[model samples]
Target: MTRPAAPSQFDDPWQAQVFALTVALSDAGHFPWTDWAQAFGATLKRHGANRALDGGADYFNAWLETLESLLEQRGLAGQAEARTIRAAWEQAYLSTPHGQPVKLPA
Candidate 1:
């Protein structure tokens, strides 16, 4: 039987969240949209050189990478902090029961 679809436009919740965050940051003038576009395009090109991009996780992963890099360069967040946050999210995701909203541990 086919699985039920998620109530989201993107394939994964994280994808949607990241997309929104990027747009919000751009809207807030944290970075120029043109810069974001150029950086994202470069990231896509580098990732695509390794293998095919299915416009799913691969696309979002590249998007996330570009955002992280931009934030790092702007001194908003460093790589170590990003890795720590990522690890926390991963742990939260893994610990949450299936079909329930994941929340970071207090």
Candidate 2:
């Protein structure tokens, strides 16, 4: 019998996008990769306390959280702004018609 293919590194496009963004930020000298690894590890530990991380949404959520916290610590972006943007995206996603692109307000 043929073996099944290995799963993709990310379950969703957003996860991949976040991963790329993190790498880009680190490469740009915003912070060192070691710092990113440390923060991401801590976030995983904290979030993993409640549930199993399947390297899917749960993992990426923790990753996104770590990135956001790091950015805030470095004075790059505020948590409030992140929340606002998330809310806006959520609203846009909910209001948009199925099979259409979701657009955020200017």
Candidate 3:
């Protein structure tokens, strides 16, 4: 039997945002799609997520890692900056009141 189509919904907005950013950055020529595929595949393998176990859960996590790796490899963003950005997101998510949008620090 044919497999069912994968759902488009993400577990959270952050996952969706990561997915969007991957596409946007790739489109902007940070890396070609072939490079993207290799990075993403390596990330998935590293996470032992090559198989669609747990219903393909953690796919976006790998995507985020791949995005970061690509950005770092392409000299677009430093590792320190990535860590800072992650911390800023965590703080924004924690401090924002429920129902309010999280904002990056200016």
Candidate 4:
């Protein structure tokens, strides 16, 4: 018997972006993949994630949390930098016109 495939598509676009960012950062050697895997696993365990239901298994947020935690722990980037970047994106998203894509401020 074959195991079920993991769901690749996320319910939200930001979740997808967060998932991609983790892979890109790992590929670029910002952090070792093993470390990332550990971080992600630790986060899932902390959150008591139930991997069966779609809503229950919203792991993208966990992925983002893991990445942020590693950045803080490893000093690749700190919490302040993460906060600033996240805030900028939030502002850009709020400022964007309806039905238009968000763009970062110049």
Candidate 5:
């Protein structure tokens, strides 16, 4: 199966780093989309539109940093280990087959 095109910022190296971090945290059970969306919305509220746009990358980076800390605190993964796992997960998700359900390891 084909993967969708990576989002615009995702094409950038630094942006891809943050994106990978976020995806990794999600996979590691740090926080689900509902929790993330709420946090993101709260961030937007505190920052307002202009700053949100201008500093969005920094915001995402901060979010990722926080996620890593949370994961470590919960004993889910250490920071370096999480980075390795995240990289593997990013490659697998973006390259694997589609249109058929695949069993994921727990």
Candidate 6:
């Protein structure tokens, strides 16, 4: 499958995380885009519009942060696990293909 472009430093990390989570989950048949979009919109409202990212990279980063927080809160992962996940994401981000939809490692 085609992968999306890598996010730039100017991009929000949380958004990128959430976007990646959404993509990964959807790819796994766990949730749909509409549901993810609705939840994302609500998250933005609750978290504040300023937290709502503008660019692809920024959005992905925001999403990633959200995912880590949620995972921690849900007791699915610990700080170490989150750190590992973040590191892996960083590596993937650096190596990801530009202008295509790439799958995040599960």
Instruction: Output the number of the lDDT-best candidate.
Output: 1
Which residue pairs does candidate 3 place in steric collision?
A: none
Ranking by lDDT: 1, 2, 3, 4, 5, 6
Better of 1 and 4 by TM-score: 1
TM-score of each: 0.75, 0.78, 0.72, 0.69, 0.42, 0.39
Superposed Cα deviation of residue 94, candidate 1 (Å): 6.8
Report, for every candidate in turn, its global Cα lDDT versus the true structure. 0.91, 0.89, 0.80, 0.78, 0.65, 0.61
> How many Å off is the CA of 40 in candidate 3?
0.8
Candidate 5 lDDT score relative to the true structure: 0.65
lDDT of 6 by residue, 20-53 (tens): 6658866886556676566566665665665544
Q: Write the per-residue lDDT of candidate 3 for residues 1-106, one digit (tens) a residue.
A: 3455876588789897988888888799777889899888888777874455342348887787778778887899978898999899999999999999889978
Candidate 5 at residue 100, lDDT?
53
Model 4 spans > 4 angstroms off:
1-8, 49-57, 99-101
Candidate 2 C-alpha lDDT tens digits along 60-83: 999988998999999999999999
Residue 66 deviation, candidate 4, in Å? Answer: 0.4
**Distance from true position, residue 17, model 5, in Å?**
1.1
TM-score of 3: 0.72
Backbone-clash count (model 5): 0
Pitting candidate 2 against candidate 6, the one with the higher TM-score is 2
Judge candidate 3 against the unseen true structure and give its global Cα lDDT, from 0 to 1: 0.80
lDDT of 4 by residue, 5-98 (tens): 8864576777878778878988998888998888788888877655442333456767777888888988988999889988999999998998
Candidate 1 local lDDT, 1-106, one digit each (tens): 3444764368889898999999999999999999999999999999999787877788999999999999999998898998998899999999999999999888
